[model samples]
Target: MRVAGLVLAAGGGRRYGRPKALVRHGGSLLVERASRTLIDGGCDPVVVVLGAAADPVRAVADLRGCLVVDNADWVTGMGSSLRVGLGALLATDSVAAVVLLVDMPGVTAEAVRRVAAGAGPAVLAAAGYPPGRRGHPVLLGRDHWAGVRATARGDTGAAAYLRAHRARLRIVTCGDVADDRDLDVPADQRGGRRG
Candidate 1:
């Protein structure tokens, strides 16, 4: 099955005080890293949704070999971005999408690969962390795109839809292979090393 990669990078980063997509991590922009992770994870025709500071992100992020989508309603919330990303993928031959967050610098390509493996048009999968915590790099089958778009509102992207169908959701254990830490605060950008 062909799976596309969707990177949500359209947030205003109000809490972080800057666009997370442009934020630097490990010598590269977060958006660049996220896109690379998706590509390395076996997703083809990756689509990146850009909203806040879209121009700057486009100018800086090496988005070659990927489709860049603009979300005008980004400030409304992540749902809009998710909708936009999934909508863009509708034009492709992808049967599903591996959704990743640009702020999640700790999530690895391996985790995405694991969650995307064997995903069919009706499969719903998410990366499971230790202690039964669920996180990103979620696999959304083409069959659920319409419902996800309908319920996606504010910052709650597909959470409600996923919850409604949790019984059928596949949990791919990734705690042992990847970390799902998100860069939400200034301290998170400090690399956890006090100078």
Candidate 2:
């Protein structure tokens, strides 16, 4: 099964001073990096959910093969973006999707590949730090899409659904390949100490 990818890049980033999708890191927009990460990680079709400053992101980002989704309710939170991204995937032949957050620049293509390796129609896996620190690039099989869509609320994303079904979840250790820390404020882009 070809695992798809979802990049949730809709947040206005009130705390970060602007939309994270337009933020530059390593000379490329965050949105561009994320979309490329998924494609390079072996995801056949990638979907990018955009909300805040969607037009500017579309104009500059090289999202040639990505399916761009405009989440109108993005002001509400990450939940809406997740819901929108998942909904878009559910309509296609996508067996599963690996969800990546736009602000999490530390996550790499290798980490995404690691997390997506265990994808299936009934699989649920997430990248984990040492000692099982669950993080993004979560792979949700089609079987759990409805559950995630229902439980995802506010900025929680799949936390509620994942928590309820913790026993069946697979934790992929990606601490060596990537970092899950996200940029929340402008200072976060100052190359903060990673410890």
Candidate 3:
């Protein structure tokens, strides 16, 4: 199956005081680390959606050689960035997209593979972590692109779509909560690296 990976790095990082995508984790920038996982998983022609700190992010990500999409409407919200990235991925290829978040530092190549492995026309990688808390980075087939674009409810994100099409959703259980953790605040960004 043809699969394209889209990394969402359009967040402004208002809570973190700096671009979270540019933050270092284990000697590599967050975006670079995230993109590499996708690439390593055999997801070719990856694209990164940049917004708040596009320039800085681009500098670090340039070496990875992935396409960088600037999401000017990022201030609008995460939903807008997701749409832009998905639209870009769809516009260039016919492959299904495995959307990855920049702040999710612990998301590994194996996890990405697990998510994409079970991808379908309208399935969401409802990642269950620790005690049943669910997380995102859902896989979407090209068929659901339009629905994702039309989504505009609350901050509920892709949950709305998955909920509406419950029968189509697939749960990819993961033991690592880090795959589910979103590093939006300063504390989250640091805690992952500590003892």
Clashes of each: 0, 0, 0
- Tens digits of per-residue lDDT for model 2 on 1-195? 879999999999998899999999988999998999999999979999999999999998999899999999999999999999999997789889999999888899999999998689999999999875789789999999999999888999999999999999999989999987898887777877442
- In order of TM-score, best first, we have 1, 2, 3
Off by over 4 Å in 1: 191-195
TM-score of each: 0.97, 0.96, 0.87
C-alpha lDDT score of every prediction, in listed order: 0.93, 0.91, 0.73
Q: Give the higher-lDDT candidate: 2 or 3.
A: 2
Q: What is the lDDT of residue 108 in candidate 3?
A: 73
- Tens-digit lDDT track of model 1 for 1-195: 789999999999998899999998899999999999999999998999999999999887899989999999999999999999999999998999999999887889999999999988999999999788899889999999999999999999989999999998999999888888888877977665221
What's the lDDT for residue 16 in model 3?
75
For candidate 3, write residues 67-110 as lDDT tens digits. 88888878787788878877787766545788788878677777
> Where in model 2 is the C-alpha error above 4 Å?
193-195
On the 0 to 100 scale, the lDDT of residue 117 in model 3 is 87
Give the per-residue Cα lDDT of candidate 3 at 142. 77
- Model 1 lDDT on a 0 to 1 scale: 0.93
